[model samples]
Target: MSEDASLPLFPLRTVLVPGAALGLRVFEPRYLDMVRECGRRGTGFGISLILDGEESGTPATPAGVGTAAVIEDFDVGADGILALRVRGTRRFHVRRTRVRDNGLIVADVDWCADDPDVDLQPEHALLGVVLRKILERIDGGDQAFPEPHFDNAAWVGWRLAELLPLEQTDRQLLLQEDDPDERLAMLLRLVDIED
Candidate 1:
């Protein structure tokens, strides 16, 4: 973690993963400051899952695993508010979260890296099949999402694990799994693969 851990936190309803893209509209004063500070320092900001509480109030607990995001785009609203587009660069595990007088949540976190040799489990091949079918069904309607982008079996499982509308706890479980093989296996169960 960088010394910039002192900066504010923005825990969201969703959990983000590394190499993922996220878009956010900044309006509140505290968050605006957080975004500006991150931009000025060229440091990433932590994104945790908001378990409970409104944006203005402090969440009782935020999921420990989160991603550090970089601002891809930002603009000033006519109302003088800021809107930002953020992309996840890497994943981190939260050590602690403290609310500041400025209404900002600061969390101490440590980075996470996937094991180099952990191959995507064999069970995930079935998940690929199911995911393709789901995409076909989804693309038939206007509510379709972008086509799945995957480089390998492991990445495919990860991409689906993030994009699918699984519960927050499920997403956190996937994030905490250090082995790509096990992650892929878990993904299979989520998609309900026959084998």
Candidate 2:
């Protein structure tokens, strides 16, 4: 782990993985300011799953591992809330956190390495096929996702982990695993794909 750097933290109930897209409706004044600053600076904020507390009033306790979220699209909703589409760019491990006077949670975090590409093995063929089918269903007769790398083990694993109907804790565990192979193997087990 590298030395920690401070990042604005958004502790939500969901976990985000690198390359995944998340839509957020911003209503709170503190987060609205954070979003404005992030957009102005063209920088991302950190998203960590909330360990305790709610998203509305008080600052929540965030989990250790988190993902960096880059704003991809922004608009003002009819209700006058800020609606933003953000993509997960990278992973980080929170070292420590503190609450700012304005109620935004800032954290000192160490960035995690991106998953290395690995060639898909024959044993993992079923997992790849399942992932492709899921994407197709989500796309609804059109390819909404970018060109997929079913032949890449790391990509396949990340996509599967993202699309699977797994618990937040389970997804968080997969995100924290540093090894792509181990992550895929764990997914296989979670999906009850026996060797």
Candidate 3:
């Protein structure tokens, strides 16, 4: 992840957690241009959850923290639209934003530190099992976790956050959290409450 710098922001209605996969359709001209530029540069774009406004026509309010995403695949959809499959790589904090003449929002952001490599504690092991079962039930469930890291605390928590039916705001809070054990603890409470 780069240090403090500027990045192109794509504001959406949902939150994107690290180590997860998301699909997007590019019909907006501004975003289309961004996609072309990223592809040309072999670089990724930043995705922030829309805090206000819609996904088109104008610049929308975006969350302060978001995930950096890289395009994994793209194809023409049945409607002849460009469909993109992106994977979240890292988290970043938006220092500020600017709107280009074309209506694209670019943010000056600082990359968050990588999650510490903490082993999954025994108490949190059930979360991993639950994640596995949920993924098994969903179609293409393994797409978000191409390689499993069930023993890693942060990995399990992030995968669960992506797969769970938590509210977008709740997921955003999880993304903002800096401690993996704390995040996992919160997930445990959320899972219990959801149950």
Candidate 4:
């Protein structure tokens, strides 16, 4: 992990993983300012899972680990709301956080390193097949995935983590894990597949 750096935080009830795409509707003034600044600088903002409180009202307790989200697309909705499509870029560990006057949470975070690439093994073949099937069912299918590395352990693990019907906390745990192999193993245990 790198040395701690400051980032604007957005806490939600969901967990986002690197390489995942998420759509958000922004109305809060603090968040609108965050979006504008990030757009102006071509930078990203941090998204952490809310451990307590609510997404709309006051500042919430956030999970320690978070993903940095880069805006991929933006538009003004018919209702005059800002709608944004953001993709997760990297993972970070929050060292500490402070609430701004407008109720936005800013954090000092250390960037988490990407795990070394590992080839999928025979034991994990079932996971790869299932992931393929799942992707095929998505709206854009393979086109949406774009060059997915089903043979790579980390990529496979992240794809499964994002697609699985797991609870937010469960997904958050997977996102926090640094070891790709261990993450895959844990996913295997959580998913029950029969012949």
Candidate 5:
């Protein structure tokens, strides 16, 4: 997150949580160019949930707090579409924003400290079980979630927050929260994962 204080901004429709995997289809010219630039520079871009406007044609308003996504894999299809796979690395707070002529937005953002890994206490064991079940159900098996961190409160909460079908606003709220235990509470109340 320190290589460049100013990372390219992408106001996306979905919120990217730290340690979560997300796949995006790049079709818009601005985004296509963004992928190329990020690839060439070997730098990641910022992803914020769009607060207003559309994903294309207009420079949508974005949430001030966002996640820095490091590109993991990419491919170009026969239709000239760029398929991007990314992993959220860290959370950031936007200091300023500006749009390019091509409608790309770049921002000066400060990286947020990662949540300290806290052992998942016994009270929250149900949450861990739910996350494990969801991960196991995905067709990719372990590939869907990679290495699971059932003992870490932050990792369990983030995985559930991403895998569950909760509203984007709720997920964005979880992303902005600084406390892993608090985030876990919110997810437990939202999904009622407890029996």
Candidate 6:
């Protein structure tokens, strides 16, 4: 195990899977510094979903599961805010996080490989179907969610968990599940409608 791996923390409500792209705006001073530091080091930042806090809002422990994101497309706004697109490269688990004097959070993380069975194609197809259905239902109420592209079973599961409007606990459950087939089944049957 590589023990020296460290990642700049950017906690949010979404999950960023490997090969997936995510856009973000940085206005907070701490995060701005984080971006600058990453640029200086030519490294990426860690993206973990905030369990019970908001960006620029509160300090809370982040979930252990997250992906390491590399800044691909970057721009600066007229008002001095930063914007960039980050592509997920790998999965990691947070050992712990510490807040800096500037309000940015940094964490020690370890790289983790997904279970071998997650690479199977059938799992991806099944998860893709369930995800499409979920999105269709959510879109029935509102019209802005973009159609997702899942390239594999692992990606399908990650993207669905990221895009779904479920609570943090549910998303965490999906992340912790090691079996792609079981996760797909749980997701497919996740409904509490009285009908």
Every model's TM-score: 0.80, 0.94, 0.94, 0.95, 0.93, 0.73
Q: Which candidate is the best by TM-score?
A: 4
Model 3, 32-105: lDDT tens digits are 99999999999899999999999997799999999999999999989989999999998999998999999999
Alpha-carbon runs more than 4 Å astray in model 1: 1-7, 77-80, 115-117, 131-153
**What is candidate 1's local distance difference test score?**
0.70
lDDT of 2 by residue, 1-195 (tens): 245677899999999898888999999988998998887887889999988999879999999999999999989989998899998888999988889899999998999877887888887888998997888788452444667788988888888888899999999999899988788888988999766
Per-residue lDDT tens digits for candidate 6, residues 25-72, read 998777888898999998999888887778775555678988789999
Clashes in predicted model 3: 0
List candidate 2 stretches off by more than 4 Å.
Answer: 1-4, 140-142
- Stretches of candidate 5 exceeding 4 Å from the true structure: none
Q: What digit string (tens of lDDT, one per residue) describes model 5 on residues 60-137?
A: 999999999999998988988888899998999999998899989999888888799799988788999888888778
- For model 6, the stretches where C-alpha displacement exceeds 4 angstroms are 1-4, 115-125, 130-151, 162-165, 191-195
Report how far residue 104 has shifted in candidate 6, in Å: 1.9
lDDT of each: 0.70, 0.87, 0.91, 0.90, 0.88, 0.72
Q: Which scores better on lDDT, 3 or 5?
A: 3
How far is 92's C-alpha from truth in model 1 (Å)?
1.3
| Better lDDT candidate (4, 5) | 4
Top-scoring candidate (lDDT):
3
**lDDT by residue for model 4 over 1-195, one digit each (tens)?**
246689999999999998989999999999999998887887889999999999988899999999999999999999999999998889999998999999999999999987788998778888899999999889987787889899999999999998989888889989999988878877887887624
